[model samples]
Target: MPILSYLVGKTRKLGLGATRSTTYYEPAHIAREFATLDHLSKGRAAWNIVTSMNDSEGRLFGKDKHLEHDLRYDRADEFVEVALKLWNSWDKDALKLDRESGVLADPGLIRSVQHQGEWFKVEGPLNIPRTPQGRPVLIQAGSSGRGRRFGARWAEAIFTIHPHLVAMRAFRDDVRTQVEQQGRDADSCKVLTAVMPFIGGSEAEARAKRDRHNALARPELGLVTLASQLNVDLSPFALSATLAEVAESPLIHAAAAEKLLMQGPETTLEQLGRIFASSVRVPQLVGTGAQVADQLAELFEQGGCDGFVISPAYLPGSFTEFVESVIPHLQRKGLFRTAYEGSTLREHLGLADLPG
Candidate 1:
């Protein structure tokens, strides 16, 4: 938070991720902190609401076990409710800076949140004044059914992972349906899928580069990461065994696991390990600048996604290549912006300003 005050001055938007834990925080704390950050950023703050998938994270929070996936989302639903109430406690014109009359605020313009819910008991108006954007943008990423419902209710933006264009389109359409069902504009929520791009001089070069990256991957790290993400002990399974054998693991997210297995029914643990060790099952876009741009545009135009969250395989190398190569092609095709369209992230994302 101390750093955020200064950070808001440096960047146009900042997203803070949070998880549900018994010992760490409450709705009121999150409400106040993000509200303060929104004020500091002049409406540039975003809250990336997350349910911690790493089972070991519970240990750090003094819990014997992680909360069940569905239950976690249930709690998050209420948590967001309290935060929204606190954020909306004050009107935009609540603050009237009149020096001559020594009047700083209109008392009638602000009110207590007075929220009492299943997951939280937040009392009154936040200590901080209303922010420029009114409140921080809400982001949620949950591919599971319960997770999707929670996101549909409140999330302004959603982060997703789908390895196939067909699946991506389906997910996007489903989310918009969910949004409309909630009495909100379908366009209000933007869906961004994760993409790992391998940009090179040509298609063959990109493939060769990807193969080299795959060769350097460590399967042991993949096992640990998969265990944490799925909340299951995959060590007991043989590396040669098919994913179908372990698909029913109670700890796993059934929907996500099925999707992975469908990619290759005979997919061995080692094969899956190699695929995941390098990338967490996101679709890999491997090609030269124009070819990659064509693929991205196709997906975007087909309603596969609103945008993408590019997860580079290597830091400066991968990002540098994309910016110098792919970005220009996308801009030339009129599929991407060549310059900053707005000052605030909300404006850039085409989100409506918060209600005053």
Candidate 2:
């Protein structure tokens, strides 16, 4: 799969972190920087559209609090719409370099996005022309109902985490339905689950490592985050109590807690505690490279996903290992890229180039 990396920072306000930001990175700068990167990567880069939701971040901008998830997505929707217009404002031939008369661009091919949306009104004729792919691929990480709807309408890739097979399959199906409901081909968008690995030479070692990491997680922060994510009050439940009863709570009901219990009967209240705190029952694929990759393959084969979003405990070097070890195995099985086959992200996604 073609990779999408951030140039500056994240809009951590949505649900993952804070609330929302009033101001920060301008569209023009991000468009230009990302365009140049796409040019360099030869059209294998994507844009992760985000708007910060940190209430503290809002306060940084002299606000009392952050906006809700719905409002944040609304603003980000307008922001990305404007960004797309800025990208398309220049036709591929606008830079018709003619050394004969010293002409560089055709005036007719250049245009502006006189965008006036509910949250953002941007008057822009982007500084940089079009990026290599006509548009930088759009990816969304939100998984809440409203977030899923927003992403299905606009996102080419939906970044999410789900632990239970039942929940993931149901969500994948529902999101696809939403895409169709929005007049888009459900298959046009792809689902990528974040697989945070805790690799070791053996299953026992890997399990130990996973336990260590889980233990390190902050409970208070996790509960706060979980409460916000599930739109439920988590304060009522005691950490020591098994979620056996919190099952009735909308936050935990029909969700992955039950599934996790089914998967690992020995899983303790503390483990369930973490899931509640994190507010996501993403099956943390903790195992050796082979075991992890095999699980990923199983998920892909079952149509639970098109691929994995390997979120390593380590950063750059960790991904390098993933690409070298797991990626090669996946490729040998005809599951991943051996070389660049397309010149653009859309092409990588099997999408047609946009009209002039």
Candidate 3:
């Protein structure tokens, strides 16, 4: 969050987002922090809401175990509710800088958010006035059924992961349906799938580069990451055994395990570990600049996603390559913006106004 806040001063038009877990922090703290960020960034701030995944994280929070999935979502729903109330506590016109009368603001314009919910109780007319974008943009990245429903209710943008076009389209369609079910315009929430692009002068070069990167992955590290994400112990499983063999493990998170199994039930633990370690399961897009752009265009045009969350394999280099090579192609094709069209992140995303 500090880094993102710092970047707000260094860059313009880049939305500064920070992930805050609903399972741990106080709703008022999250509200005040993001509200301050929005004001500091001139409304270019976003909060990536998460109901943290790791059980170890629970230990840090003085819990014996992580909250059950659906229960966690329930808490998150209330967390967001409390935050919204706090953010709306002060009206947009609450501040009246009338120098002549020596009045700084109108007390009548501000009201306490007397919220007492299932998970949080906050009395707030937040210390800060109403933010520039009304409230910081809300973002979420939960692919489970409950997670999707929670997101549909609040997320302005959703980050997702799907290995194929079919899966991507299905996820988007399902989320949009749920959004409409929540009485929101389907377009109100943007779905962005994760994609790791390996761009080169040609497709073959890109493929080779990707293969080389994959080869360098340490399977053991991936097994640990996969274990953490699934909330199961992978150490007991033989690396040579196929994921299907352990799909029925009682300790595993069924939904997350099932998603991994989708890669191929026949895929060995070693291979799966390598894949997860390398890309964390985000789909790879390997090709020349134009070819990669073509793939992204296809996904967007085919109802797969509203956009992508580019997961670069390496640091500044990978990001630099995408900006120098792929972005130009997207811009030339009229698929991406060449310049800033709006000052605030909400305007840039073409998001609808917050519901009263």
Candidate 4:
């Protein structure tokens, strides 16, 4: 009955530094650790690789100063490259059983991969053998210049938090171009964006709910947040003043929308600032089940997004309602499956068979 595997993201620290940080985990250590998780979870492991931009993260790594943006991703590229070699080190049939004469696994079947790369130099095979599934599914979360390149090259799935359709389409197109340029199949990756639901049975009810949600957000917090994003202070501006009078921005976007704001339909500076303060211009889905389903289908069909990350505004009950009520409607309409058929997440997403 377990369904809808989200990105269990971990910070990918490059270099063979001791796998420290409750905040981050190295791929080499994670590859071995996550294989065990995959074994236990019936092969549902999605590694959402994130190289953080936060300076606090740098301090955790024992660096007094933060890394340059270029260096962060440069290391990410090498980190993933080594991670793949580590994953593939154990072939699909690496574990061969020989039941007679006290034999266990065939030694010939197990081979060590001596991988030496720019950022990592792993000596041999991963501790665990090839899983029932090939490997943990790789999810990439970044929308910056280097981030997109990383996602296009390696991500089987993309976690995006886009503000609107026009921006969403541009993201898809840009990544698709990278796919074409890299000589890889464009369809191999799926882009999932974040959309929060605030169901209402009627339009008036929905609008009222949105107003209530907005009421919970203070304009000062909004102003400060917006200022931080734009790298300026908005304290000088009145809360009632038009945002354009205070600052200029084209749109709003997030990485969990997973990329910084991408160019799309124009946004008023006020509306754009609101997006930063409270996520979801209309990320709040206040509608009936049919209405919500219709919106989702429309987004998938017209917006060109493969699916949504779908965060719950509240905790357990929120996701619980979605899983129990909304998912069945989706299944009945043939938008989602009633059950999982594959062991690993990759197999679940139909990527195990993809040519590398």
Write one digit per residue (lDDT tens) for candidate 3, span 56-137.
9999999999998899999999999988888888887889999999888899989877887777777888888989988889
How far out, in Å, is residue 341 in model 2? 1.4
Candidate 1 lands at a TM-score of 0.91
Best by lDDT: 3
Residue-wise C-alpha lDDT for candidate 4, range 1-356, written one tens digit per residue = 12222222231211011121212456678677656656555566666777665555678678775666667787778777766667777766656666665665656666677767666677767778776455667787677778899789988888787767787788888887897788878878888878887655575775676677766765566656545543344565455555433333223222212222332234344555566566544366767666777778877888558878787766656677666656777888898976666545665576646332
Model 2, residue 111: distance off in Å is 2.1
Global lDDT scores for all candidate models: 0.81, 0.66, 0.90, 0.63
TM-score of each: 0.91, 0.76, 0.96, 0.78
State the lDDT at 349 in candidate 1. Answer: 80
User: Whose TM-score is higher: candidate 1's or candidate 4's?
Assistant: 1
| Model 4's TM-score against the true structure | 0.78
Per-residue CA lDDT of model 2 for 91-118, tens digit only, reads 9889978999899888889996798767
- Distance from true position, residue 329, model 2, in Å? 2.9
lDDT of 1 by residue, 204-288 (tens): 9999988898899877677777777766678777888777766755645675577657758788778878888989788889999
Off by over 4 Å in 2: 1-29, 218-221, 224-273, 276-280, 314-321
Order of candidate numbers by TM-score, starting with the best: 3, 1, 4, 2
Worst 10 residues of 3 by lDDT: 248-257
Error at 61, model 1, angstroms = 0.7
Ranking by lDDT: 3, 1, 2, 4
